[model samples]
Target chain A: MTEDKKSVCKPTVFEELYKKHSKDVFNFMFYKTGSKANAEDLLQEAFVKLWKNCEKVAYEKAKSFLFTVSSNLFLNEKKHEKVVHKYIENQNKSSYKDNDTPENVLRQKEFQDKLNNAIASLSEKQREVFLMSRIDKKKYAEIAETLGISVKAVEKRMHNALVILRDKIGKI
Target chain B: MKTEDNIENKDIFLAKWIAGEISDSELKKLVSEEDFNVFQEIKNQSEHLSVPNFDTDKNFSAIKQKLETPKKKSKVIPLWMYAAAASVVIMISFFLFKTSSTVIQTSFGEQRIVMLADSSEVILNAKSKLTYQPELWKFERKLKLEGEGYFKVKKGSTFTVETENGSVTVLGTQFDVNTSDDFFKVVCYEGKVSVKQQNKEVILTQSDAYQNIQNEITTWNSKNEAPTWINGEISFEKTPLKIVFESLEKQFDISIENKTSSNKLFTGTLSNTNLELALQTLTSAMQLKYTISGKNITITE
Candidate 1:
């Protein structure tokens, strides 16, 4: 029954899609831009775009459209100015650094700093693939579809990302 | 050996493992491999990398608001046409305002307190939503409810609460109404309340609990000021296992998959604060085994 009804995108269907996929899209944006506010804004823009073009997009393709739109929006914003520094600044100001033992807090701060630096050193494409795989938990094929690349390419990028991260965070 | 072939194979296994899709034999094979410790360490470190919690409700509401706002235009029209457009706009806005209602909703493992226009207090239970029109409060004090709520209506007009299965009407009373997929219950704590279900009307005064299970109406006595859910515990009496588990899901925000045919009736009490203890209490009483992974729980006999 749902298969037959998949052709026409009703408001209720759109809402269900939103409720199901919005978290994944938001996490994707969060990984792209390490700012919660920016991620939230991009998520809204992406879903609003999908809502406006719902007639053209099938229920099956909405997730890819959302990811593509959100990633493009992040890239466009990056083209205007460098936002990585701001991301790091916001990371330092995050609430994760509180209410722990002094030694443990210091260790956590050092670990977080090193991890962010390691992620920052990766190539843009590798970073995107890695984050989509690890953070968003997207399938390789889905990531490939969203980025308009082959599944093999996604695998290669993910492998490169892991190699770099392993080398950077050595012996941990 | 950490050769390219081994690394590639390990990466494939690691991906499958992280996705929780790896078979047991494949997992054993991966664990037996030489560079398995390296992959394990990387996975552990990667899991510690934190992402900020995204407030889905807040962002979704923002998107809905943006969708509601009309796009701007920069065209100029004649004065007469402008007057006609203004009247049309006024009419549309008026109708929109008339139909607009205030909604109070609570997600799983959450509860909320809502004060209506007439100062009637309503305590919404977990996984519930209550919608009412403030504009029509004076003439028609009515509310539409889903899930469960405890209402304390101030004495004035006839206040009514409507659900999918039935409707409850009262002049001034304190009562509890629960409307789920397969259950409809109304428990009157104070004053007189009338419940109408499928052309059958049942009126109760105090300490009366009316339940309709599979279209079978049952009445009992509950001598309490409010429902047991308000006291941080949920007490059930001869309820089906499925309904009890559904309530547990709502109270804990967990997905429960019942693998066995649990046709047994359970009469037990569980605390909402401690999840592990609650699960222990429930599963032990039902003589079932359960496993929990993250927020998902699967129960079996």
Candidate 2:
């Protein structure tokens, strides 16, 4: 297993993997925890862990490893925080809204709030697949690899997530 | 349009659209559908979701720096490798120091004073050369000399001067040794010196001189404290005319051509400071005529 990993995990190969997947992993973490600081911290921790185990982890499995490590970390953090504490904490921080007219700003803020609440309402599996597909701009094949599911399963979960988000957020 | 089949088909289309795999016609067809606006709105908003600003260059540089620093548990060089490297350095330094032995030479008509590693002094005559190993001087006072030199040895261990013809060994004394082609001479000034030629050994004390001419060994007494040539005078005692002319050539930086036989012996002194007067003195004493052209002197009888 070590020799198999060493054949694939060269430094240049690892760097290419980091470039290909880091932003997606960061977005996956950010949407999962809904906190930029926590997402950044988890992103660094995931890659550092990848480097530490670089010789043991195969290059092709790097994406799955990053997503799995990041999601587990997010789940562990979620188990420690009370729902009320999470709500209050999210309420204190405003999601990024572009500068516009007063009415536009209010409308964008309302839509962002509804979007966040809609996302928060999703099942863990559905949300993970949806975000990996949508926000990370990953293909169904990549989403399936990361979530350890079939491509058809990834599509089904992503479709369910979109339907649920559309219902919660209402019309545009 | 609101049928279950239509809903399933729309979900597949929406997934394709979000994955950016939808063809242009497929996208146009989807946009014209009734529920397309909702899915498009979700897709647009999701794409615009803000992520944390990650400075990848900065983070990668930090990682690179961490990897470059030698870790405490990194593989240590093997002991034999360190020993090999040390031996290589030792060999290089040994060769560098050994080849730094002192070598002194004087051109024709040029004289110099040399101070050895042990503070001993030597007055080297014209066309002389001397060499000694400075690192081994204290343990063994040995030197190699060519041509002639006057040595004022400091009282120490046995001082040995080697020449092409023979070797001279002394304890602590002043002496002069002249080693030229087929001729070797040693004159002791203040102390004793031992001369070895082939199987023969000769020792000389103060004012004692030993000369080897054409395989013949001769001894004589000197009235002066040093060789006369050192004081701007060239003196010879039963020396061949050929040797006398060779000395003149060395002392005056001239080339002498003897067209006639020069087997006769010469025993006289000539002033070394004046070329013309020295030539006159030598020629008149030998009843030989000579002519000088530039630096060349021709002798004829």
Candidate 3:
């Protein structure tokens, strides 16, 4: 938002944009395409496109621009994508430490795996909204803005994604 | 019915819960305890999920490298694609060249100077037709000729002039070829040429002439620098009277009837551009009288 970051043509400002949004953009592409390599490629391509049109893109609008561009790039590609799973890192130990039985640990791990699969199997739209809200800790309004969708749509996807995950794990 | 009502309102309450707009008491008012518990677990578990590592610095430099050499980035079109395109173009042009031939024809009493693709010159005589392929001329300098033509070939590949009776082949030369019914003659005025007739080839040099008239082949020498026809005069050496009359007919676009049918061979030069002068010269030399009547002429010995 500063005057220094106004011109994304500058290397420093461009890098600033890249650093701020590259992870989120990369994650968004990963959630859509379900391939890390594809995500990385789209990430690079989106930033490169941004750099090409740096003079025109305002710094505040760059994040949504990157998301829109990355999503469009993913859509332009062939739709035969593998289901996304197993990118989930370990959970915080605080919740599990109190009930640290070996059977409890194994059950938690199983639940987590099922949860990951259920999330991955969600429709690409729902998974995108859910993860952006939960993993990125983005608000529904922020998710809707980044995704160029209505806040109501984001919340609906989030709720539907939770319902699917709960169904998959089935009362555990 | 109460559970059905709660299920319908679940979207609103869940949206409120996820947005942190509703506390537990408010969420518990809309949904069953078990459903709220499941939603909480799904959210908590999802919070732990994250995308794989992306090295920001490494990719930034990659993008920087791409931007730095903006001109070098091109579509990943394979080399075989270019090769395939080139082959297609070559094939199309080859077929076009094979199927397409240019024929240059000069009507009666008409003379045309055709400059070939290789800059070779062909001065087509009256009632002559020349056919060649311009695309294939670069590799092969060959053409079919009917009637008479004077060729000034440039130095390159072997140039060939094909006629019904014989063909004349030369590396580079200036020559004159005249072919009609039962008469084929090639006169070389510069450089060297090989005249082939009925399984026999005879090479000729400056001012050398070869003739095959009525199946009798002979070689003669000429004293002129070039073909005399090019200078508005048609010259011949011991040519048959039938062929001479035919030549006059072609040049003047007039039918000549030689009533004498004389077997004597004619040797003379006649003005081709002037019908009266040419008739006078030919008839006087042949010791004959000629009368003309509107595109028709009669000769009596």
B1-301, model 1: which lDDT tens digit per residue?
3355456666554455544555544555646443454455555455555567778788888776555432332111222221110000000000011124656567787776666667776777788877777667778988888888888788998988888787888888888888777678788888889888889899978878887777776787875666777667777766788878888888899989999997787877899777889889989998999999999999999
**Among the candidates, what TM-score does chain A have in each?**
0.74, 0.69, 0.89
Q: Write the residue-wise lDDT of candidate 2 on A53-129 in tens digits.
A: 88777776788889898888878777324321122123423334545678876666676677778877887678767
Candidate DockQ values, in order, are 0.20, 0.13, 0.35
Q: After superposition, how far is residue B95 of candidate 1 from its true place, in Å?
A: 24
Give the TM-score of each candidate: 0.47, 0.43, 0.48
Q: What residue runs in model 1 are displaced by over 4 Å at the alpha carbon?
A: A1-172, B1-99
Candidate 1 yields a Cα-based lDDT of 0.70
Lowest-sum lDDT 10-residue window in model 3 chain A: A78-87
For each candidate, report what fraction of the true interface contacts it reproduces. Answer: 0.25, 0.29, 0.66
Ranking by lDDT: 3, 1, 2
For candidate 1, the TM-score is: 0.47
The better-scoring model by TM-score among 1 and 3 is 3
Best by TM-score: 3
Q: Please report the candidate that would top lDDT against the real structure.
A: 3
Q: What is the lDDT of residue B250 in candidate 2?
A: 79
Deviation of model 3 at B295, angstroms:
99
- The alpha-carbon lDDT assigned to residue B80 of candidate 3 equals 25
What lDDT is reached at residue A172 by model 1? 37
